[model samples]
Target: MEVVSEDIPVVIAFTPNYFVPVATCISSVLRNADEDARFHFICLLTEALPEHMQQLLNELVGELGRFTFMDLTGTLSADIYVDPKYTIAASYRLLLPDLLPQYDKVLYIDCDMIFRNDLSELYHRVDLDDNYMAGVFEATLEQQLAHMQVIGCAPGTYINSGLLLMNLKKLREDGMVAKFLEAATQEGLEFPDQDVINQLCKGRIIGLPPFWNSIRTFLLPQYKADFLRFYTEQDWQTVQRKGNVHYTGPKPWKTFTVAFDLWWRYYFKLPKPMQALLIIPTKLSLLAKIYQTFLGKTILDGTRALYRKLKRNEG
Candidate 1:
């Protein structure tokens, strides 16, 4: 049966395998909404996702009933055409034209993000003067060059695609999809999608801030940057009180161990018990991801060593 749900206005994302918890972006937006109905969270995929990822995302979606699943491969919607490449988020830009009519505006965020505060400001943040479609801001040029080098593009001129506040109508009018495909094939363009978009939307873009498109904070980088702490720390207890949140990487779900628990605590205080239960394990799974990350592995190893020590003490 066709799922004839009401059309919504808000953010959108195209993720496969449920590998990343993009919920951190939606969670804060939903929680901080005074209107409660201002936006919706649309999840686009070719098939049904894992039941476990669905559970947490469902909890995050809350009563807004804002979460949705799209089987693009099953449908002839002609809406989304994402090339499954790790480069420039090819699949995401494909979601533009088809997604435009669904919402007046939408913010697309990578799953590696954690919301430290409300981000509703992004909803209607488009700059119409230039007919510019979407806006993303970064903190440092060094970081920008780093991101460029990641997807194989040259240094000094790359933009991150982790978080986007898009004006869908503008994107469609610009024929953004065809433009992207053409740009992707352009010679000397190494960072397929990111480089194409930066050149396509270049001056027309409305510059926001570093926090908006905080990039490369999650993955392994040549070195660490401090701006990351601005988004992820949960308790704010440590001297290094978490400020930065990762935008993409294996360490994604791990932020929950620090932040999601605090988020759930506040969720329970304001919401109900059942709702809280629905959210807690999401934290575990995300945090469990630390087993593969540097910090997670180091912590887990220390934990095991401590456990053995305690057993030896007791013996």
Candidate 2:
């Protein structure tokens, strides 16, 4: 392979239940990255990964880069709030500064996403300055403003923590790790770790373009106004070409979800022998095309109703 880029350290955190998703995530990165791009993945696990899975991950990387797993089974505090859709391991990202003391900068990506292009540009080009971390803003600011304000974060600055360009050196120097853990465990903090980061890192966080974390919510036709309210036409156009699809709610694995086929392509590329571990039920595949149309429409209708209700209460 030709070498043209510097080594970029990427961090990902997951639990035993997310092994297949993590595998797909890694596969996408390796498959889509530039031929010259080099990466070293440091994955944080909530428990000891099975030996066979570890070997499979190693094989997945092959000569493209390195894959290292850090088992953190007993280190986390149990009090952190965990959403029903996610596992307790989601909060593990807060420990990155302490966990990887060697790197001043690292890219943290959630396992539920897939890359459309090489990450070298995003990794090497972002300027963090004195900020603790940088990430794309979550879409639909109007609907989310009240909730953001309740958490003490400025409406426009609240970002989705899924994809982050972290300045570990600054985070460590400012003692943000301890602060993050403390805030994560606090009661009534919606989104747990994400709320803590926004609440505490206010004024010190950087917001990147939407393509880095393009959530499924952006595609809802009912939210056209909301989408334009937060991002420019140019931003939307760019995302269409290069967005790293984030499967936020209703993951492709378990439900009929938009962009499921994009994810399926990457999973299908994984070693044929190991592909069986990640197969979806035959019923889901057979019915996916039939329900694809209504699934999105239903979600939009429900979201519109909720938006109207929120507007009435605010009025």
Per-candidate TM-scores read 0.59, 0.87
What digit string (tens of lDDT, one per residue) describes model 1 on residues 1-315? Answer: 122234234444445533334554566556655554444556666566667667666765666655565545543223323344452233455555664464545666655555553455555444555444554443334545655554443432234666666666777777776776665654444445556677677666665544444445322222234334332332222212332343444342334332333333333333343243333355465555445467876786677668757876897
Q: Which model scores highest in lDDT? A: 2
Per model, how many backbone clashes are there?
A: 10, 0
How accurate locally is residue 312 in candidate 1, as Cα lDDT from 0 to 100? 67
Candidate 1 stretches greater than 4 Å from native = 1-8, 12-16, 23-25, 32-37, 50-59, 74-90, 139-157, 185-190, 217-244, 254-315
Model 2 residue 5 lDDT score = 39
